[model samples]
Target: MSTGLGWRDGRAVLSAVHGRRVHEREVVPGVEVGWLLGGPRRCIGAWLEGQDERTPCPHHAVIAADGAAVQCASCQSVDRGLALARDQILDDGRTYRLYLAWFGEGLLKVGLTAEQRGTSRLLEQGALAWTFAARGALPAVRRAELTVAASGLARERFKSRVKPDHWWEHGDVDHRRALLTDARVRAHELLRGHGVELLADHPVTDHVGVFGLTDGAPDVYRAVEALADGAVLAGRLRPPIGRHLLLDQPDDGTPLLLDTRLLTGWTLAPAAGRPSAGLALSERVRPAEPDTQEALF
Candidate 1:
């Protein structure tokens, strides 16, 4: 059954984010029905959380644009703290791998995840190119991330809409790999200079097969700025690039790149004909104009 909610374990499910493009019989059954109906028949309800709780509150309460659930202010506070402490905890309590992820030309980010997650974490972030720079205990990985950031090698995060479509098309994988390799070499030197132990060699991976890298221009269904709460979004869903969704809006033959994060704290239901609920005044923000430039590097 489709619940308007797409989040699971604090991450958006790949199928829900990609819409009809990703087919996993286990998660989404009757693919044809979903495609024919524009997307999964689901609805978004309230956002609920509890103080120091590992699970969401069962109240199913609505939330604000900033993701604060008015009905559960205490939970919201706890959620914020948990977000800050995420790096300190891992599900399996195993070694963590530190990575250098490259986006458009020169865009890089330093991140750490459980060693067992493999490429899953990278995929979730929609990294155009990435490589594992080091692996070690949590403290070591944390230190590596701090050192990389302090050395000006990369940032901790990037804007969701900053990614330009051109890089995906005209981007050269070999060139990117070369850049990553060079960065890796420099990173190792920097770590050693800081007296940090070098745990392992970097492992590189490209997202071409997973994200469908192409030179063809994407179809624009609508601009992200035009979306409003209770605005029923329906159409052919394209593979996600980073956290953005390329939706082919049926009302008008336009393609739009929507940030998946925007769907995080809302109640959503399948768009049968029109939206049945409205967003709170505080939840609405004017969307930004779509980027028309070549690249955001």
Candidate 2:
């Protein structure tokens, strides 16, 4: 197979990485060349593809879903692709996106809320962004929605200047670290107040709960994946619980930290002295029950 970075609309961004000459060609959706450089190793890559209607360069100005342009070679493309990539680029024109994940039950619900209130609540409850599920379990803010417009002509320009990394670190997006820490401290205080001992500084898997729920929740899965990645990047997490868990995997598997904390709302009082085995996607967990407290986030 010829090598290249393929955008969603079936166009290939051609370049020579090492001995490989990259060019675009057809591949299945949700799969692309993983990497183009180094050993005969390859990968199928996917990216946000869209267009830019107000492109200053006339070549890129007329946006179409599948057409490729010659002008502004670096960014020459359709309207939707530009729109998709616009959110990921920094003011310096470098493109990147924040990867985050969150663990815990109700992670998806916490991610959907628009108000910062959800974030503050999580921190106050002593939650930790310890796993991808936990990190991703937080919320995502739309790039376009966060930008402030100065004037009609300057609006797109303003958006173009916003950096993804900056937004991640200082933008309106709420990761809820402080709230989670507070929650942890409070949980600790409560534990101490009641003379309960924390069994382990960090608990390992004693129960396995398989969630096939991702069958219909791609967006939430992506956020959770990113959150997991961010936690790994931040030195807050490790890998699967043990070697047997690792050896049973497919060779190409990408396992991430799954935060059982997301199961925080599972049960306030342990089940027969331990957390219950979470149900599959079929039996959804609720935040409140007759005996369980509502989730912090």
Candidate 1 residue lDDT tens string, 115-139 = 6666767766778788988877777
Candidate 2, residues 1-297, lDDT tens digits: the string is: 212222232121222222223333332222222211112122211222332222233222222211122223433333333434454333322222111222332231112111222332222221224211111111122222121121111122212112111212221113344333333343333333221223223322111111112121111111111111101111112211211011111233232222222211111211221211221211112223254444543
**Model 1 C-alpha lDDT versus the unseen true structure:** 0.54
C-alpha lDDT score of every prediction, in listed order: 0.54, 0.23
Error of 2 at 91 (Å): 21
Q: CA shift at 253, candidate 2, in angstroms?
A: 2.1
Clashes of 1: 16
Model 2's TM-score against the true structure:
0.18
The regions of model 2 sitting more than 4 angstroms off are 1-22, 29-36, 39-249, 255-292, 295-297
